[model samples]
Target chain A: MIKLQNIEKVYRTDTIETLALNGINLHVAKGEFLSIMGPSGCGKSTLLNIMGLLDEPSKGELHIDGHTVTRLSDKELAGFRNKRLGFIFQSYHLINDLNVLDNVELPLLYRKVNAKERRRLAAAALEKVGLSNRLQHFPSQLSGGQKQRVAIARAIVGEPEIILADEPTGNLDSAMGNEVMDILIQLNQHDKTTIVMVTHDEQMARKTHRLVRLFDGSQVQ
Target chain B: MLKNYFKIAIAVLKRRKFFTFISLFGISFTLATLLVLTAFLDRIVNHEYPDAKRKQSLYISGIEERGERARSNSGLSISYIKRYVLPMKLPGAIAFSSRSNGTNTYFHGKKIGIDYKFVNSVFWDILEFDFLEGKPFTVQQEKNLEKVAVISQDLRDNYFGKDVPAVGQYLEANNEKYRVTGVVRNVPASTYMLSSDMYIPYTLTKDDMNTPSYFGEYAAILLAKKTSDIPAIKKEYEDIVRRVPHTQKRFLKTTSLADSYLDAYIRGGSQESKQKVWVYTALGIFISLIVFLPIVNLVNINVTRIMERSSEIGVRKAFGATRKALVYQFIVENIILTLIGGLVGLVLAQLVMIILNNADLIKNLHLSLNFTVLFIGLLTCLVFGFLSGVYPAWRMSRFPIVKALKA
Candidate 1:
């Protein structure tokens, strides 16, 4: 669950000022699957980033799982993120140096899980995503869909309450995009995992339980 | 946790082999220079005054006033010794002096040039020379002496056959025959005062002492009963010299033997001569600084490399890695790199020392590992590693997850 009230994010250069998010108020309940749709410069990703605790709000009240995180220190925020939230990026951002198994095990490593348990949990996550056979394959060797699957497995390996998928299908072909979307949908349905996906595709947005559209810097129902 | 850091460091180095090689080579070259300089300095400092007992011996010389000018002489006039030194009730007061020169001649049919010093009977008591054959001459033999000599092994081998008895055999010196009484080993090349091929009693040739060339003032070496009483004894000797009625007006003052030796060598030359030691010291320090500069530059490069890993740092931070952990990781990485370079540098230095020693570029040149050098090298590596890593680690850890991720 996440909440944002009157959130404002501004970017300033030496000669100009830009409003990334303005007076935005939104909420997502537990186990809810929400898709945020917006044009290129409409602050959709900015809003998602703020909700994921990755960015600070110029003026806002933010609550995640009943704790107000707007005033938390950087160290505290990082700890909160590591324990409660997971991230799946459009680029799949898996460290190329590591294999699929190690990439998936990275989140648990930060959690200080013993190596044996980390390996077991990472293998199980890979198995759930139908990537058990590709555990040793590096991201460079994997197809786009397989990389995305690996990213999803990494996200779920920590057993976090909320998963933030930023343009999850942006880099994949349509068929691979469908497969990634299906995996996300299955996670939301079977495991009751809450997922907030940001995408520009109308058809993709239509598949989620609810959609929040953004124009300029404001959110709309 | 440390294992993980090492693994990550290895991975980084393996991935960027060229960068690693360049950095390592730069560091290793600098370290090698440092090692060489350190070893050389150690040799210079430790090689001086090999005989600890010699420090207890005082070298007494004379300063003569010829009209308006005062000349300090390292050689002792035998008259001064008989008049002042022998009459003193100072126990352990033994004095010896020598005249040294090189001569070439046939030794057992082989042509050779050997250095020779003609000294007195008291020379054996003052200088601790180890004899390989026969015994040192007695004071009675020197007082009631005839033609007698002591030869070094180098001269014995050259003049007589290797197994031939050199003692009691007559050797030609300045066309005059002198019987050999003793044979001693060759002196080490590193010594300032050299051991000689032939030592003849000063009494046997007392007539030669009357000539300024033969006496030239012999080096009057004095061994005190208690070395700690040297200052007092030197003061007494100076007082006796000042009282010796001189026709020159400048000969009115007293001077210690230490001051006399210093006045002879150190003061007689240009001021630059005194500064020569400081020049060597400065050169040593300058070379060390030259080596230090490249290492500092490499440290800066290491800092920049660490900065480039900000994204990885941010991800690690987001994974719950503390600022301390990040610092530790970077410092450990630097230490590992430097230690590798240090080992390579040590090996390189040893190789260089071996080559130089074999070539005889420097006398007795050898690489030695001592506590001071070892401590300095280790401390230098640790301090540099920490200093180089701190700023980069701080900058990396300060990265905002949102900004870094977006970048």
Candidate 2:
């Protein structure tokens, strides 16, 4: 479970102070799949980043699994994020230099897991994502859909408490998008994995356990 | 984990050939030059063959004459060595030698330049010289001012042919004919002190301690019976100097062996006789210059590399890699880079030394890769790598994962 209270995110420059998020209070229960839908520049990605601990809200109380995470040091936050959170970017964000197996093993590597075991878990995760045959293929060699599949495998390999995906299927074709959506649904249904995804598709939003819409950095409904 | 990072580092370097080339250029060029200079310095400060007893030997290269506002200095004379130096009972062997002279001889219708050194028989006892044919001129030969001379293998080969015996033959030099008494191995030009092509007795050069002012063209090398005997020798020499009624009352006299090379090269007031901070400062700045240029260039290269790899760093951080991990990865990559460069630099340094020896840039100067030089070279590369990598690594590691990933 994750909680955010009176969250405020402000972007500051030499002569500008822009409000990216304001007075946003939300909570997602354990094993719940949630979708955040909004137009472009509606702070959807910013909110997701804040929740993922990749960026800190200017002012807020953040609690993950009943533990305060906002006050944690950078080092502590990294450990916490590694153990509790996974992120899937619209770009798939795979390290292009590494092969699919290596990209999938990234999360487990930070945990100091043994190489042999990491390889096993990564292979298994890739198998679940239907990418078992593309183990040695680099990201450059993969199709858009296959790259997304590899990203999903990387996300679930660590078995984190929460998955934060920003536009997980934004760059894929309709059929590939649906396939990815189906995989997310299967994870939510069979694995009972909580996923907080930000998307613009109403059909995708309807498939989640709950949906929240944001406009101008505030949750309207 | 480290192995993985190393693999990635090597791969990444291989991926971007231009960046790798730029980094290697700076690292190798910098280390090569520094190692060459270091090797030369080592040769000068630490003797290997002839002057093996450099630590136990004291040299009187020159003397200073001072009187209130008037002062003058010159190389030692026979009078000074006999009255003030050879009389010392503590010396294992006291030898006097002339400063190397240049002369011309005809070998097979070609004019050959030869460096000539005039010395007493005791010179043979002080420094170790390998003899190939016959033996050194004896004290009796020196006393008799014998025309017999010692010639190097190079000179023997040029004049009498390599197969013929040089010891029994006569060679004409400086319009004087002398029978060869000994043939020695051709010494490298780097060995500056005893690197002459020909050797003759100082008595043959018309030398007696008849000079009155205690100054002439000679250097005395005093080998101590025991290292502890040096203090007494120095004290006794200074006492003899004090007692000498100056040929010129206005000329105050002082003489001591310059302790270090800096002292020998830099001649001045009493300050020159002791170690100065600027000497170390100059040395430090010289060494830093050799190392800093490459490191500075490397820092810029590393900065560019960090920028290019920022996304990869973010992905790693997002996956739970700590700032420490990111920093360590970059540093290791740099270390690997520099070590490769270090090996190349080492090879380059050997090549430079070979050229220097072949070119005869310094007389009898033969340099090889010793353990000390290799250690210094490797350390330079490592430190250069670490220094250049840490800053860029730290800067990139501080990037917010979200911002970096988006970039």
Candidate 3:
């Protein structure tokens, strides 16, 4: 479960201040698959980043799993994020230098998992994504669809409680996008994983259990 | 995890070949220069040679005489040593020598230059020389003004065939043919006083003793019975000097070898100026100059490296890595980089010494990477690596995660 109240995000320059998120409030229950839809420059990605604990809110409080996360130090927040939340960016963001297996194993490495277990779990995650055969293939060697699958495998490798996806299939073809949406739906329904996704695609938003649409940094519909 | 770091480091370096080359170029070149310099300094300061007992000897290199307005500084004269220095009962052996110089000798229709030094017969008694062919000339031979000499192995190889004996052969030294009585191992260079190709008895050539003066071209060395007695000998000489009855009507004094070397650099004549401080400061500056540029350049390179690697760091931080983990990783990568560079620099340093010796760049500068030089060279590598690594590591670690991902 996640909660945000009176969240505000402002971008500042030498002589100008622009509110990216204004007086926003939202909450999601456990096992819920929520999609946030917005036009360009609507602060959806910023909200996701704040929920992922990667960015700070200008003025607000965010609670995740009954813990006040906004007051946590960077170190504590990182640990909390590692154990409780996972992220999927629009571009996949899989390290080009690492093979698929190593990329999946990266998150567990920070968790101080032993090498043997890290490899075993990473392989299992890759198997779950139907790419066990591509463990040795680098991100550069993979297709757009395959890269997104690897990112999903990486996000779930540590078994985080909440998966925050920012445009998970923005670059994929419709077939590949449908395949990714199916996997996310299966995770929410079978694995009971809570998912929050930001997307511009109306069909993808309609497929989720709930839709939170934003316009000009505020919830409109 | 360390293996993983090194693996990534190698991959990253391989990925950016030109940047790696730049970093390696600076690191290797700087380390090589440091290696060569420390080796040279070791050769000058701590090498073992003909004067292997260097620690047990006291030297009177130069003497200064002052009168109302007249001032002269020179080596101790023969009569001056006899009246003022030789009477010291603290030393086990006493000897004096004229400064060494190079003289041209005719050999096989070629003018070959040879370095020759004049020393008393007691010089052989005070110093240790490894004889290769025959024994040093006797004190009786010196007393009889024998024209016998001791030659270095290198000189023997030039005059005679490598396998042939040069002892008892007449070698032309300064246009005079002196019979060689011994052939000793050539002294490795930088021993200064004991570094010479040939040694001839001073009494045989210039021992008239009646040559009377307070300041003449003569320097004395006193060998102590035990190394511990050196301080006593120095004190006894200084005590004798104070009462030597200065005929200059101005001032007279003597000094130790360390003081003599220090005074040569001092601008003022006043002995109370604490010239050692200036000497140490100059030394500090020279060392700093040698170290500063490489460190500064490496720091800049490290900054660039960290910037280029920021995305990886950002991703790691997003995963779960703390700032300490990131800093530790970067520093470890840097140390590994410089350590490899240090090894390359060491090999190149040896090559440089070989080239210098072969080209006669420093004339018998038989430099080798001694233990002290090696330790300091590696220590320099460590310090250079750490200094070059810390700033970038800290700076990169401080980057906000959201911004770092954007970078």
Candidate 4:
């Protein structure tokens, strides 16, 4: 579960000020499959980043799993993110140097899991995503859909309570996007993993249990 | 954890060949300059003095005041030697008078002459000369007569053939037949007094003390009881000489062996004496500056590279890498580079020394890998690595996960 009360995020230059998020209030309950639908530059990504504890709010109270994390130090925030949340990006962001297995095991490495256990867990996660045979292949060797699947596998490998995906299907074709959506739906239904995905596709947003729209840095019903 | 970091570092270095070459070359050049200069200094200061207790040796010279200007000479007259040097009760004190003219020639049956020195009996006790055959001339032989001599191994081999005992055989020197009392190994050129092919005793037969013309012409080597006693011994010798009836008004002085050794090279010059220290200082400064340039360049390059990896740093930070961990990783990486460079530099230093040794640039010049040099090299590498890595590591570790990710 996550809560944001009157959150404000501002970007400033020498002579200009931009509001990435303005007076936003939102809540996500446990085990919910939620979709954040917004047009370009609607601050959907910024809000998602703030909710993921990757960015700081200029003014707000942010509570994650009943702990107010807005005042936590950077080190504390990183620990919380590693232990409690997973992120899947639109570009996948798989390290080019590492193979699929290592990319999937990245999150758990920060958790100080030994190599054998980490490999075992990462292999199991990849198997769940039907990528067990491609463990040694690099991201450049994988297809767009396979890369996205690997990213999803990385996200779920750590067994975090919440998964944040920003445009997870933005780089894939329709069939590949449908496959990725099916995986998310299955995770939400069978594993009860709370996933908050940001997407611009209306058809894709219609499949989630709930949807929140954003316009001009503000959330709308 | 450290092993994994090392594996990653080595892999990265191997993968990026150009960067690795640049870093390695820079570090190796810096380290090579340092090592070569340090080796040179070691050769100078540590060749024969590292374990030598000969610091106790002192040189006795007489300063005579002639009018307004005073002239100091390291040679003492026979009278001065008899009065001051022989009566001294200093515990390990031995005095020897020597005079060197042109390089003399010696003939066995008819082979040409060799360089030689006419010295006294105390020469054997004062200098470290290994005898190849027979014993040194006795005190009685030196004090009573002048028939005995000492020859070098070179003279023996050239005149009497190798492996033959030149001792007890007559050698012609200065148109006189002198019987060889001993054969000594050639003195190393690095010594204060170079080795000679022959040594003849100063018999003091003709009562030359009364002759003021040759008062301060001969060279004297005074071996003191201890290095600490040199000043007192020199003062005593000076006081004793000045108290003599005829030489009372004259100022007599004594010099240390080091000063005499230096004066041997630079005669008629007191100003040039300071140039020795200046030369050593300049050498030290030049080597230090040369080493510093590459270190500075490396630091700048590393900082820029680390800046380019800000996003990777952010990812590591988000994965729970502490600021300490990040700093440690970078510092370790630098140390690894420097250590490898130092080893390469050591090899380079040996190659240089080998070439110089073959060329005979420095007689007996050797490359010694002592613990001190190794310690100094490692410590220098550690300091350089830590100093160069600190600011970049700090900057990299402070990246905001959000801003870095967005970028």
Question: Which runs of model 1 end up more than 4 angstroms from their true locations?
Answer: B44-49, B52-291, B368-384
Which residue pairs clash within candidate 4? Answer: B105-B113, B105-B114, B106-B113, B106-B114
Lowest lDDT 10-residue stretch of candidate 2 chain A? A93-102
Q: Mark the regions of model 3 whose C-alpha exceeds 4 Å error after superposition.
A: B65-72, B205-214, B241-280, B370-373
What's the residue-level lDDT of B116 in candidate 4? 65
**How far does residue A126 in candidate 3 sit from its true spot (Å)?**
0.8
User: Roughly what TM-score does model 1 have, to 2 decimal places?
Assistant: 0.74
- Model 4 misses residue A34 by how many Å? 3.2
> TM-scores of the first chain across all predictions?
0.98, 0.98, 0.99, 0.98
lDDT of 3 by residue, A1-221 (tens): 89999999998999999998998899999999999999999999989988999889999999999999999887898799788888887888877767898889888877878999999999998888889899999898999999999999999999998999999989999999999989899889988999999999999999999999899999886
- Relative to the unseen true structure, what is the C-alpha lDDT of residue A166 in candidate 2, on a scale of 0 to 100? 93
Please identify model 4 stretches exceeding 4 Å from their true place. Answer: B49-51, B54-91, B94-284
Question: What C-alpha lDDT, on a 0 to 100 scale, does residue B390 get in candidate 3?
Answer: 91
lDDT of 2 by residue, B179-275 (tens): 9989987766655456688989888785566777667777777788878877777676667766766667787655455333334433322223443
In candidate 3, list every pair of residues with a backbone clash. none
- Please identify model 2 stretches exceeding 4 Å from their true place: B66-71, B207-209, B231-255, B258-271, B274-281
Ten-residue stretch with the least lDDT total in model 4 chain B:
B264-273
Per-residue lDDT, model 1, residue A94, is 80
* TM-score to true structure, per model: 0.74, 0.94, 0.92, 0.76
lDDT of 4 by residue, B1-407 (tens): 56545755675577677777888888777776676667665544555431133455654433333323565444556756666567876636555545444445545446465666667777777775678898788888987886888887877887788879888999776667789998887553344243466777777334476655325545556666667877776676656655554433454432322233334323322223355577658767887688677778878877776766666565666555667778888888888877887788778766776787687654334556566666666677777677667777777778777666655
**For candidate 2, what's the RMSD?**
2.5
Query: Could you give the fnat of all candidates in order?
Result: 0.34, 0.71, 0.48, 0.34
Candidate 2 per-residue lDDT, tens place, A1-221, comes to: 89999999999999999999999999999999999999999899999999999999999899999999999998899999898898888999898778899899998888979999999999999999999899999999999999999999999999988999999989998899999999999988898888999998888889999999999999998
Cα-based lDDT at residue B145, candidate 2: 73
